[model samples]
Target: MLRGIYISATGLKAGLKQLDTVANNIANINTVGYRADITVNSGFEEKILNYAGKEVGKLEYGVNPDINYLDLSSGKYVPTGRNLDFALVGNGFFVVETPAGLRYTRAGDFQVNRDGYLCLPNGSRVLGEKGPIKIDNEELYVEKDGRIYNKERSRYIDRLRVVEPVDPVALEKVGGNFFVTAANNVRPGNALVLQGYLEQSNVDPNREYPALLESLRYLQSNARGLKVQDELLSKAVNDLGKVR
Candidate 1:
């Protein structure tokens, strides 16, 4: 009876974790450059089985109930009319300078800062091959090759630094639509940049929202199952105590 209760409780807890991941995906569905997370389940086998004081025996264990977190996949890109808005046409990341240090992002939404510096909406300076590309005038041009040019001077300012980490999953997503890579990951040597476009979130809200709802329902059902098991256990314990 106690074992049954433990198993049901584990199920309920795992269901809740699945629901949490689904809810997070739904919440970020509309976020620019957001990647949706995937969850996987793993099973564990019983170490030993003691059946009603009989000899301990080994039985083929079924899939153990556990949730494994998968990496977020790349999302699709959408076009925006803004000139500074950018996106990656292929596999790569744009470098940005934040207070914490340099970071990467698929979000190309950018604007010229007060100091005539091209930067993300959050004021993180966009990095170029030479360094942060500073625009002195409104007539600025960025090429697919990551070159920054000025119309007034007709000169190339710098090439944007587009680094590709060896393992994308090794990067950490910081707030403001940027990613920080692990210490060992190599810095991307070259990355193509697209101007006048923005990468949209990969999450399909229409699909994820409903799935999240279903997970919620599953969690509730499991909770009810656990409660029922708990009640039965309580009654059994009470009855056993009363037996003289």
Candidate 2:
């Protein structure tokens, strides 16, 4: 019965974590270039005690909650008609220079800073093929393949640095649309860049809401199980010791 209580408790915890992930996904539904995270869970391995080669008992069914993996898929693209707006239509990430170092993101809403350098809303300089791109105050024109041209200067400034990591699982979200990856296996991406457009969040409400409701139901069931287990334990300690 104690073991049953522990199992139910673990189940409750897993359900809550899953629920939180679903809620976060819904919350970022409108964010630009946002990807929803998925909660992964693993089951506890049964522990069997052996008494001099004879098995005594086996433990079962307690779930082990695991990490959240980013969904890495592309989102819908909305045309902004802004010269600096960009969107990636395939697998890739735009590199940005943060204070911590280079971070990757899919959000392409950019602006030319006072210094005439292309930067994101948070002021992170957008990295180009040669490094941080320097521009002379001019009208910006970017081709589908990421080549940037300064209309006023009549010169090609640089190429936008869109890279693909070896594996998406190695990337971790530190907030906003940025992702940090430990793997150094990054290469130039093949995705086409759409200028005058921005990528929207990838969350789908119809799917996430149903999943959240299902997790809530599972939590409620586990709560009922906990209540039943407590009642049985109470009977075992108190009623079982009573004399008629």
Candidate 3:
């Protein structure tokens, strides 16, 4: 009886965790460079089973919660017709200088900062191959090779710093459409920068939102099983133990 209760409790927890992940995906559906997370329900360890007091054998156990994986697929590109706005065509992320150090992101909505440096909307300086990109002239154009050009000055400015981690899953999310990766995992990527465009979030509400209904049903079933277990326990302890 107690084992049944434990299994039901694990199921309830797993359902709740799945629901939370789905909710997070829905919330970030509109966020740029956003990646949805998936919950992996790992099964429990092997357990010994006995029936009729005869050693039956080990049986498959139930599932528990906690494992999650990030979906690193890129989203559709949106053309904004702005030179500073950029989008990556392949697997890569743009580096930025944050107060906490260097962070990686796929969001390319950018503008020139007051100090003549190319920066994101929040003012974090965008990194180039040399360092923080400095764009003093308004007339700028980007080539397919990711090299920035100054049409007015008729010279090459700088190449955008695009890097990819050895394993994108190892990157940590630090809020505001950014991810931080280990310095060692940073490597040159094969992605081409598409000027005048931005990448949207890869979340698909049509498919992901339906998971909520399934999770809710699972949770309700587990709760019902747990209640039945509790009632059985009460009957066994109080009624069956009576001296009548």
Best by lDDT: 2
Judged by TM-score, which candidate is best? Answer: 2
lDDT (10s digit) by residue, model 1, range 35-63: 66666544452323323445555332322
Cα deviation at 208, candidate 3, in Å, is 0.6
Give candidate 2's TM-score. Answer: 0.88
Candidate 1 least-lDDT 10 residues? 58-67
Candidate 3, number of clashes: 0
TM-score of each: 0.82, 0.88, 0.87
Write candidate 2's Cα lDDT for 57-152 as tens digits.
544567756899888877889999988889998999999999988899999998888898889999999999999877756778888899999766
lDDT against true structure, model 3: 0.84
* Candidate scoring better on lDDT of 1 and 3: 3
The residue ranges of model 2 lying beyond 4 angstroms of the native Cα positions read 43-58
Between the candidate structures 1 and 2, which one is better when assessed by lDDT?
2
Predicted structure 3, TM vs. truth: 0.87
Q: In candidate 3, what residue range of length 10 has the lowest lDDT sum? A: 44-53
